[model samples]
Target: MKSLIQIFLVSALLTTCINVNAMTASPQSWWVGMQTNSLQIMLHKQNVAKHQWQLMPYSGVNLHNIIKTDNPNYAFLNLEISPSAKPGTLVFNSAAGGRFEYSLNARKANSSKRRGFDSSDTLYLINPDRFANGDSTNDSVKGMLEAANPIERGGRHGGDIQGVIDALPYLQKLGVTQLWLTPPLENNMPSYSYHGYAITDFYKIDSRMGSNALYRELAAKAKQHGIGLVMDLVLNHFGSEHVWMKDKPTADWINFNGDFANGKHATSHARQTIQDPHASDFDKRQFSDGWFVATMPDLNQRQPLLANYLIQNAIWWIEYADLSGIRVDTYSYSDKAFLANWTKAIMTEYPQFNIVGEEWTSNPAIASYWQAGKVNNDGYTSSLPSVMDFSLQESLIQALNEDESWNTGWVKVYQSIANDFLYPNPDNLLVFADNHDMSRVYTQLKQDLAKTKMAMTLLLTTRGIAQMYYGTEVLLDNTGSNDHGDIRIDFPGGFKGQKSNAFTGQGLTIDQRDMLQTISTLLNFRKQSAALSQGKLTHFSPKDGVYSYARTSEKQTVLVFLNKHAEMKSWPLHYMEEVLGSQIHATELFTQQTVNLNKAVTLPAMSAVVLVIE
Candidate 1:
């Protein structure tokens, strides 16, 4: 472990920009292709904005525009590449006594054809810092401000990309086709940098996590394992410790730029107001520009240079890592105009790529407004393929906790699913019972094993792309606290010497083992079930404490039954006659038991049953 750290440190020292001030170009390399015909090269030097810059020669690339920001230290050179421009180095000579050189990296063949995740894929969300620590040496790098402290609930826990790479086999066995990792870029804040949301360097992966190359390695390995990688991105803000924070790129590079001196701002957290037509200009301004906290600064994407920089950063990641998709954080917080361009640009570059935005609203109307085909009343349009299904998530949890009654129990869930029309593509929405930002499903269900199983069944088999947080298979829970540190705890057996090993199924309770097995069984079945993935879904409203739905395709039909009662009984099966189409019998996937569909179906108390109609 010590030797690995030594090698990592040596490697870091040998390559890449640890110091942005020393480099002529912000990004040392960029892509050259038809999709990305023009490149915006940002040069940051002492008073670099004061002078004129030009291309060193009339090569295949032509200098289009040199944009100067209010901040004298930063300048943007917009250059267009001719179709004949071969991938090579292009130098920009400036009167400021420095020449910025940038390498035009060759785009992989069929780069624009990379496909992103869809309903067929299930995402396993992992917080890399807490998932596992594959290497011990990088736990506490010499110069990094925050050292690894697993004891401190909110501190860095030493998990990195390698830990994830090593756990690919376990994920494959669990049957998730995609891995949605939290942001891994450099979050060089003085403390609480483990979340990785407060990115200090966009181009550089955090050293604690390993190099940027290692991140790509994780992506490549995941691909080989039939697992797609969904990178979490934050375009709304950056850590105050970011290099650009010290050097003013423009007067409006950051919202409330003066307030950033101290770090915190008077944010309203009124997320819905961004979509409200009745919202006052002052309130909208406050919500959009307000600093997130003392350590994170809200970016002013209205500035063209800053907007271009962020959009280009997204492109760089897609090409560099060959990512399956991106999960945008705080999606609506960015300037609306800038966001439209950001999403449009990415889709233009890779037409098949998918991007899901987090709007975090429980209103279907509010969330639907962010989907690609939404025709907004205010004339706002979104290029986003999907959105986090917060409305369905809230209803699912609420429906389970309440007793069966009119608009009380299963009806709440039925209504939520019925609201699917609000979205352009409901199946594309990222659906989950819980995520890193919320309580775990186990705890959210009040630790009731039966209810938890029911929740998992709906998430896995029902409409939409499912996303299960890591440790969900084993019933990970935060029983008493709402703190994020408590929510994202260590996986029982991910690290070495843990007495409880989820991987090996040692030190696990009978209940934990049961839950784990049940989750595994359903996931593996869903992996091969075309009906579950590509079928048309039709559900009946809840009656007699049993709610039912069916996902049917040309080849198969899966009938899902949910019974909320405490005791088993043969409920009326007449409602499914039409969907089953005279099929009198079916086989339960989980138990392999055969039952007559013509008669009443008997199921366990508070249980979810997936029956394949013959």
Candidate 2:
């Protein structure tokens, strides 16, 4: 009897241990990790049915453990499944409880071959809703922001990841090295949110644009075609309807939620406070925590969990998609300390990675302070490598619009480059004519094709990195209003039922085709020119409305001349006599004609030429 009692006691103890282990396990938890050319997944305590435990076998499921640990409660399972994984729910049986289910989605591993920023690449920025709509099936998603009319400038015409993928060849042929699309993260809001500025879920891609799998495919395919992908990241705020807003993670997760905290007025002076240790906390909060727009709720990165989550999400995308770079929106609006840490961490993993912040300040000092090498008075450091040269943009617009004058006018462009001394490396700055926010460049230049070509020439041949707004090559216009919807117009023929398609080379006006061909030729020429890629830039502004520069190295030389004034201008060869050093032969890049270097050259009004000295 005593022996029987001992056996029963031992059996009871063993049963209790098993039950404890089963109860502690997370039955609903599922995770993915990267493996060699695949992903490995581990499902914890998968409960398929009541009182029965079964493992559903899956073939072609590659699995790897990112965090291999004995601690069952906190282990991360990574796996790579076949790219053709069926769209279905994952159901499994739990040993101690009921069944569990999770959605299985295809995710691609990051590419290992490509890394870092390239100098020769030109980025084309596009607002997806305004770009193209390849699929109409998901145009009006349930419980999503209502679709607006495509003709009604502000309406959301469904432009998904697939649309971009389909248009890749068109962009590539135009000499675009990188494609920067607006944030495609989930922004399930109530109204007027087509811009994708207000993000709700950091981890999930907007379903309306297609699933996260499609996004990864876009990135991979883009790289294969020699086009890099630049993701637009938002760290300042999220839509008020975000899930976290309903459930406060901590008491101080947000600022002034109970009362209206109207944001500070736009000021270039505020950047001075970012590096000042003596700056007031109120000013700092206003700069970092203030709302960008009323509908978007500001995020407080001081909260540890929120900061960590954001940092991890960024890294996950970079590693998962093998992104070439990230274009951070409203970059200065985030906490300075957090921005520094965020950039530092990302740079540590990907040293050659390129990150361009949107400072949007017209002052060189303010913009330069945020760049990687500016030595702030207070010793505050930022790891950001590049900033959008808003200062140059401001000068360029003014120069293009005003009449020629001795002190100002077209000379403002020359004056703008003089401010290049303010930047540690002006070559690293990102120069652009216009983006999605402002008026289109062609519209700003009053729809003059000659002037448009002149601006394009200046942008491409300038010292800094160049980024072209999408549709600029085709002279797409939004002249009547500055509304975002007006600026982001649909690309003709990107949709299925459209009368014309830019990709098929149909429905384009003669002018549009000419512009496209011109841009393509220039891009292809730049691709093979070593001088344009890494040579030092030297400019000669002998007179107003005439600017000439040479990008030269030991073996190659590229000379660019811009004549903005009407009629022909005679430039004496003696002005560039120094540049003619020991070189008697020069070929016009655009016309392919050899020109005499000993005499004056007649340049047509508003004409630009790129000459390769051989």
Candidate 3:
């Protein structure tokens, strides 16, 4: 081990080097909201903690406190801004350094009143690096650690915010009301910068992706087209290469002793065990404190300062970009109490906004525990409004692929929905057939066009916010491999001179075109149907290779039938009196053909049929 004199000498050298440079402050811009009174500005400079900071007497802003840390490179300045403070720059000076100015801007009109995505919205998830390269010039931005490489699956492909802007029209026409892009923040990693999950600079967008202004522009443009933007955020950990790794402000800024190579600090992937009543302290610590990956250093939210920093970081993004929602990655991996507080803080600010946590579990019991209003035995409460419906996704695949049985196939789909009692509000769940990390839904059903369409139909008509992975409409599949790099294939038309263009519908197979049309029909119809958006669901038990469900709103009712039988089969309607009571007529939503509800409804073999009560 190094001696005390050696450690002090090293620290002194760093402190001296940073001292020669000017002081830096975070949150270059601040929005003064109704409840956003005090703002914490973190100052970064060598030996910054050694000097006291004071704010000049200003009209509407006052110095609350200056919080210094163990590291000499950082200090926190808490400034309370009164309502009278107009949009201008607030200056703070330190005897140790010079002036640090932070601009305050008036929030946009009706910002707090902005609505988050819900069941009424269809989320279209896209990987930016694989979407499209709008500007080739930005493909290889100078100084960025990574270079653009289309042939490299895990490398950056130059897809930026401008590419997303160009696709807004296409996405809107496809009937998606919300666009969820993977993280666009700066990830200056040596490799795998395309993923954007390993955030190096939270305040700035990845240079390769575009500037922060462009990201805000994407949100603005999307909003103009009646589309909301959902930003993917990570609260569990950040890229290990983050600048903080060089000069940490506090000893516990990161978990695992700030060392991922340590075998003792490796993650145990024991998330569900967090809710176990008999779980040991060791197991609980391992789940919450371990590093996410060697390149990602787990954060210690138990530290109140770090917790507030993260909470403010999320709020900063929402306010900066006018975001409609946030999808938290690896929700259950962070400290449980910190997660609770984080959600509460966001909800308190944006009561109408929505935040969906990525709890990738096949068990409804565990996923439900993360939703708001869950009365856990351990007294755990979550302010999270929505969670990804991994259970339903898995069940949908099984329901279509496996044969019907007592506890398998169609029964799997039925029983999963029956577990809705576990969630505080099942309609708020984000349901999807597959996402970036999973095998494409088309591949999951063995590339059977009929099964793929049926799955899409079910998800569109089901009782939650439906999300479709990019290229799913065109049957993008990776065969049977679970490799994430392959699972997220580039959209056929994203690049120039591609084999086929999804945007222009060029060079596509008959099967692909048919699947695309099938999904387009269902999504467009669902967009106009309140019954499929915000409605009550009633499903019956599977019977004779047939499963049925209904979504009914005030005056609109939608009935979905899934038939796996070999030949055309008709199911009696007399038992469906609750939904079809006294209704003698129905309209086939897909074909727009009228039919009699009093007689048995005929279902095609291995197909999904939708009808509206008339």
Clashes of each: 0, 20, 0
lDDT of 2 by residue, 1-614 (tens): 33422432332211111232332221122223322233222222322112333335555443343442232222233445554455444443446544434444333433333365555778889887767775677777877766555666666778888889988888877778888999888878876557788897775677777766678788889987888888899987787777556644445655555223454422223665676678897777666666656667777787654575566667667765668999998898888888898888777656778899998888887888888888877787989988998877877777767777786665777778888888877888898989988999889988888777877877887777788898888888988878878788777777657766677779888888877777777777766667776778888763767778888877888888777788788876676766768777788877888977766776878888787885
TM-score for each candidate, following the candidate numbering: 0.95, 0.81, 0.95
The lDDT values for all models are 0.85, 0.70, 0.85
lDDT for each residue of candidate 1 in 1-614, tens digit (9 for 90 to 100): 33422443454321132223355465546766657677787877777777677777745889999888677787788888877788776665656555545567688889899999988889999999989898888888877889999988899988989999989998899888999999999988889999999999888889999888898899999999999999999999989788777786887788886365453465677877888889998888878888778678889999888888888888888878889999999998888889899999999888899999999889998889889988888899889999999888999999899999987989988999999988888989888999998999999999999999999999999998889999999999899999999998988877766789887789998889989989899888888889888989999989878888999988889999999999896877776777888677889988899988777888888899899974
Query: Model 3, which residues run further than 4 Å from truth?
Result: 1-22
RMSD for each model, in Å, please? 3.2, 9.9, 5.8
lDDT for model 2, on a 0 to 1 scale? 0.70
Task: Write model 3 residue lDDT over 11-89, tens digit each, in one string.
Answer: 2211111233455566656776557687887878778787777777778899899898888889888888888888766
Judged by lDDT, which candidate is best?
A: 3
Q: Give me candidate 2's TM-score against the actual structure.
A: 0.81
Q: How many backbone clashes does candidate 1 have?
A: 0
